[model samples]
Target: MNQGKTKKIVYKTVLHIVLIILSVTMLVPFLWMISSSLKTTQEMFASPPTWIPRYVAWENYTYMLQAAPWMRYFGNTFFISALTIAGQLITCSMAAYAFARLRFKGRNLIFLIYLGTMMIPFQVVMIPQFKIVKILGLVNTHWSLIVPGIFNAFGTFLLRQFFQTIPKELEEAAKIDGCGYPRIFWEIVIKNSKPAIITLVVFTFMNTWNDFQRPLIFLNDDSLWTLSMGLAKFQGTYVTQWNQMMAGALITMVPVLVLYIFAQKYFVQGIVMSGLKE
Candidate 1:
């Protein structure tokens, strides 16, 4: 091979080696979580540490299930996540559509102010938000969780950016066919925005499903606790059950993992498309 070709080969090989090392580093925690879940408490703390349990403790899963109302937590989380996803998709998309397609006064200013809300940390608004929820009589109810999450500044910004990329010709044509704003939105915008919609769905679902703080503040009822809250039961003041916690954590990860797996293709596309502008 020529010197240039040899140099390219060496560079590519070194790049691959570095990537492999980084990939393995990122995977270590996940792999260890799986391994720890299958181990007994004693085995988990064994000298030199064991990557694979000598004896797989299937009882860890059973113990985890018996320790808490995991099935109910799962149901509550799924229900909350579903409603949040639906609400965000509808509300954010409409807001985005208006900002993207419709001409109105102060549109850019309004959008900028709305987007500025994203910079405010949730901690700053936690107390006021709870008070508002209480005033609306939604405190200690699922609505408290679902309502606040439904309208997100980030989601609006994401969808708006994506909506701006759609060809104006499509909307104009739809109007020529006697389609009103609603019909055009449904047929022209939403129908063609699957990638962005699914991307938002995955984002909203993951956020709602993994949320711990909001539920912690709003939901005082044990029956309404999410998996993140339920996992706290594995932790004791004096001694934490490492194995059971790992098992419960693994269980909690299943839904998020399944969601990302199915939406993996559209998720990437949506993110990329949302960043593009006409």
Candidate 2:
């Protein structure tokens, strides 16, 4: 028994060591980015790249801020991301409810077709989506980004799986108490599905926030450009501002990081529970 206990202890210790190593490995790039953001161009490219900058270039951030209309870029990004999250929550939840609960003809077939859309890469649909948006005269507008991102197949699938795991007895009781489908959905299913909802919100926010290609294709005006677009153009025709670029990149990551930190518990729970139903 003592030998068996020792073996289990060794196994657990080894597992923890492996996980710590993997965590540090993944953090290396992020750590480097932070280091680079604080360094001058020369120090950033020094022969032996220093993790600690000899001379911290605080001006890099200030320069990056002055270099672009970051306020407008942030406003545009937030506007688009907020609307996309709202629209996805409403549309995806409704669709997922119908798919998970309602008995309708061709539901499974329709769901399968909808799920198949996830397999299609964004690159494949870019041209056609661009043409459609152009025809709608939404080119050079934020709506071009918001409208395309409003409904997501993965969000619907995730919510539907979570909704299915909800006990039907609570819904039945609500029905017997004269509660309608809308009431039951709002009070029962939605209230219990917080983790899944938060998970979808995080995913939608991250995708919309980081999305570069869609905005690039649809928006022609500089004022409509997002952080991604703004950062891409930070490079000069003759010179690349590596330090300033790294600073901007670091700042760009803050929103997503804060969001994940807050929603991490729910996100992990949602991912685990959603898979259990399938």
Best by TM-score: 1
Q: Write the per-residue lDDT of candidate 2 for residues 170-259, one digit (tens) a residue.
A: 999999999988998899999999878988888788888998888878898889889888777666431677788888898788888887
- The alpha-carbon lDDT assigned to residue 247 of candidate 1 equals 91
What is each predicted model's overall lDDT from 0 to 1? Answer: 0.88, 0.87
lDDT of 1 by residue, 1-278 (tens): 69999999999999999999999999999999999999998898899999989999989999888878899999999999999999999999999999999998999999889978877999999999999999999999899999988998878878888888999999998888999999999999999988788888888887889898889899998898899987774464316778878898999999888877888886676567545532
Q: Tell me the lDDT of candidate 1.
A: 0.88
* True-vs-predicted CA distance for residue 18, candidate 1, Å: 1.8
Error of 1 at 179 (Å): 1.8
User: Candidate 1: TM-score?
Assistant: 0.93
Model 2 / residue 249 / CA error / Å = 0.9
Give the per-residue Cα lDDT of candidate 2 at 109: 100
